[model samples]
Target: MIEAVRVSGLTKTYPARRGSAHVVAAKDVSFSLAEGESLGLVGESGSGKTTVARMLVGLAHPDSGTIVINGRTRERKDHGRSARLRRAKEVQMVFQDPYGSLDRRLSVETALRDVLRWHMPDPAKGTVRARIAELMDYVGLSEKHLGSRPHQLSGGQRQRVAIAKALAVDPAVLVLDEAVSALDVSVQAQILTLLNRIRAETGVSLVFVTHDLAVVGEVTGEILVMYKGEAVEHGATAEVLRRPRHPYTDMLLSSAPGPDWHPERVSELRAAFAGTR
Candidate 1:
């Protein structure tokens, strides 16, 4: 299978503030995604997964790394507006807050049409409308809702619109940084199911960055477990969840709420693992 995304030796650090040492967000992180494959980037709050996602979508520039998508190696710095727009077509990110990502003033139809026009440029008059309808349908939204703005929609509906807008560009890679974490449990399930169907139909590679292991299990086939800005484990999702090799991975899995979950044990593990890392 062809590779859709490849990241090598990615490292990013923030300068020290207030006389403290510099902060390292990701250190020598490397991973690959085949065409149509989904990989979960799982970690706690400060594990650098979000940093990696930001870099993948060109939102953050890495101190050192190489990122290649769909046979194109991205330049270290995007040179101009044209280059940035080209990168937008290669990789799109769906942020955690749907409301923050979208414009409250624009209707859903207008938002999608704008993206298509920007990336695709001067499609036939009826083509844009048809494409907008297709994108809305892909995200389980109907034509009636096209006139609604972000404030008029529920959290889940807004997120679906966000996904549709991201898909409008026909990006080779979709980076979802905690995309479903803000919704209710039932809503999260629906969004996850929608993502799986979208992947199946479009064959777009996915980098699902999330803290919830259960969430990743629904959408990804492989997993990369990160801890304290480092990749501690990488393997098949089922194997890693069932039989995690790293202590941090074990702690993460055990920390999940389940019939067998033990908070005391998780605390102990966290304390024990802190020294090892």
Candidate 2:
């Protein structure tokens, strides 16, 4: 399989704050994403899920690790302009808070235009506008929204705009950090469906970071369970869901919200995950 993303021994630490000792946000973590495949990163809050996701997109620098995207390995030691551009093309991130990520001043069309203009200069105005319109359509938006700002749209619409912005970059992979968690359940489902369709159509690999296991089931084929800054278990999402090997994985699965959850599933999960470690 062609590897779109290969992460190994990834680690990050922050200096002591509030008289506390230095904190390790990620341990020697390792995972891989095949080209056109989606992987779920399931974990609790403070489990370093976002830390790992942020590192993939250069939001948070890793203390030590290898991040190879689309056959290009990013040298953490290098801070050159060409390297940054290469990494940007390899992966883009859709943050949890769509409203916060979008510029308050930029309208829907202008926001996309800025990215296209910066990335590809000398394009005729007609070309830029046509591409921007295409992007809006791809994300299920209409040209009527072209003049609207972030605050003017609904939560789901804003998120769709965020997706459009990410797609505008034409990245090979998308590192989504709780991209749909903030919206209502119906809206979340809509976003997930859109993402699955987008992946099928574009063949862009995805690293979906979220605490919700059921949501993981909805979108990913493989799953990695993280706890306390470490990846404790990983395998087929269905296998892990039906037979979690790590106690932490079992706990997360049992605690996850479901549309038809019953108390008995918890006992079943515990027994299935038990003694399998």
Candidate 3:
């Protein structure tokens, strides 16, 4: 399989106070994805999942690490603006907040047009409006919604726009941070279906970061469990969820609602896991 992304010994630290020790956000957190494949990074808050997403998209700089996207190695700081823009075009990010991710002032067409204008030259092979129409169509949005602002559409609609914008650049990898967490259950399912279709059609590799195991199960085949800024477990999604070897993975599984959910079982798992620590 062709490698889409490979991250080695990635770590990031933030200074908290002048006298106090620094806070570590990601510690030796490393993983990789293959072309046309999907992987899920699951953990609760402060698990450094978001930090990993930020690092992948170049939104945050890593203290120490190696990130190779597609085939090019990424520098921690030395890549110039043009190089960074090329990287950005290669790997795009779809943020969690639908409304917050998009500019409310711009209409749907304009929002997509703005991204196309950046990556594509003026008078691009196709007109900007024509490209915008294709993107909206691909994302299941009709041309009638072209003039609608984010507030005018439902949460799911706004999210579709975000996804379209990410696809605008034709990136090889897409880092989706809780992309469907804000939508209703039905809407979430629709979005997931759309994503699966997109992946199947475009062969775009995905790095899905979310706290919901069920959501992860639906979209990803492989799983990486993170805890306290470190990767605690990694394996096939079904195997990990069915027979979690790590305490953190087991704890996350036990806490989730399921057909066999028993109060005592979760407590026993928690107690056993705590004893190990």
Candidate 4:
């Protein structure tokens, strides 16, 4: 299979605040996604997962290293017409919060229409509505939800709408940044099923960025574990989850509540640590 997205030694740094040192968001990160494959990027906050997501979707440029998509490497100066258009059409992102990512002012139909118009403009105008409906169906949404605004829909419905919008561009790569973290557990499962279905039906490569190991295990075949702005461990999802090689990865897995685990025990311990603060 052809590689859909490739990153080698990807690095990013932010300028320091008044009294702080420079912030390194990504450090020598390297990975590759095959066409139609789903890879999970797992880590805690400030682990560079979101930074990698942003760079993958062209929202941020790396300070050094390379990002190759569909055989073309993205350079800092490639923000020209052709590059921008290609990036928009071939790569897309689904953010963590559907409410924040979507426009409350626009109806679901209008939001979808705007994306289709921008990315798939060559389609006949008369066929756009049908295409929109098809996309809605693909994401398990219906026409009734189209007239509703983001605020009017349930969390799952709003996320489904967001997925539809991302698919509007017929993108080859989908960067999902904490795509289901805000939804209820059941809703998260539904969204995961929907995403898996979409991947199976459309053969689009997926980069799922999240802090949840269980969620990642459910959907992704490969896993990359990040820590301190770098990838500490990476391998098959099952392998990594079952036999983590890094200390950070082990800590994350250990922290999750297991079948025989007592949640209250940890809560009490944490509370005691706080010392009535």
Model 4: CA > 4 A from native: 262-277
Q: What is the lDDT of residue 238 in candidate 2?
A: 87
Sort the predicted structures by lDDT, highest score first: 1, 3, 4, 2
The number of the candidate with the highest lDDT is 1
Candidate 1 clashes between residue pairs 3 or more apart in a chain or in different chains: none
Candidate 1's residue-wise lDDT over 1-277, tens digit each? Answer: 9999999999999899997999899999999999899999999999999999999999899999899999899898577989989898899999899876799999998898888888778687799999999998889999999999999999999999999999998899999999999999999999999999888889899999999999988999999999878999999999999899999999999899999898999999999988886
Which ranges of candidate 1 are over 4 A from the true structure? none
Model 3 lDDT tens row, 1-277? 9999999999999898988977898999888899889999999999999899898988898999899988988876557768777887778888789766699899988888878877776575668878888899999999999999999999899999999999998999998999999889999999999999998899999999999999999999899999878999999999998899998898888788889888898999889988987
Candidate 1 or 4, higher lDDT? 1
Model 4: per-residue lDDT, tens digit, 90-116? 799998888766899999989988877
TM-score of each: 0.98, 0.91, 0.95, 0.92
Model 3: lowest-lDDT 10 consecutive positions = 76-85
Q: Could you tell me which 10 consecutive residues in candidate 1 have the lowest summed lDDT?
A: 116-125
Clash number for model 4?
A: 0
Clashes of 1: 0
**What are the clash counts of all predictions, listed in order?**
0, 0, 0, 0
For residues 110-182, write the lDDT of model 2, one tens digit per residue. Answer: 8998888767779865988888988999989999999999989999999999998888878999988898889
Model 3, which residues run further than 4 Å from truth? 18-20, 78-80
Ranking by TM-score: 1, 3, 4, 2
Candidate 4 positional error at 151, Å: 0.7
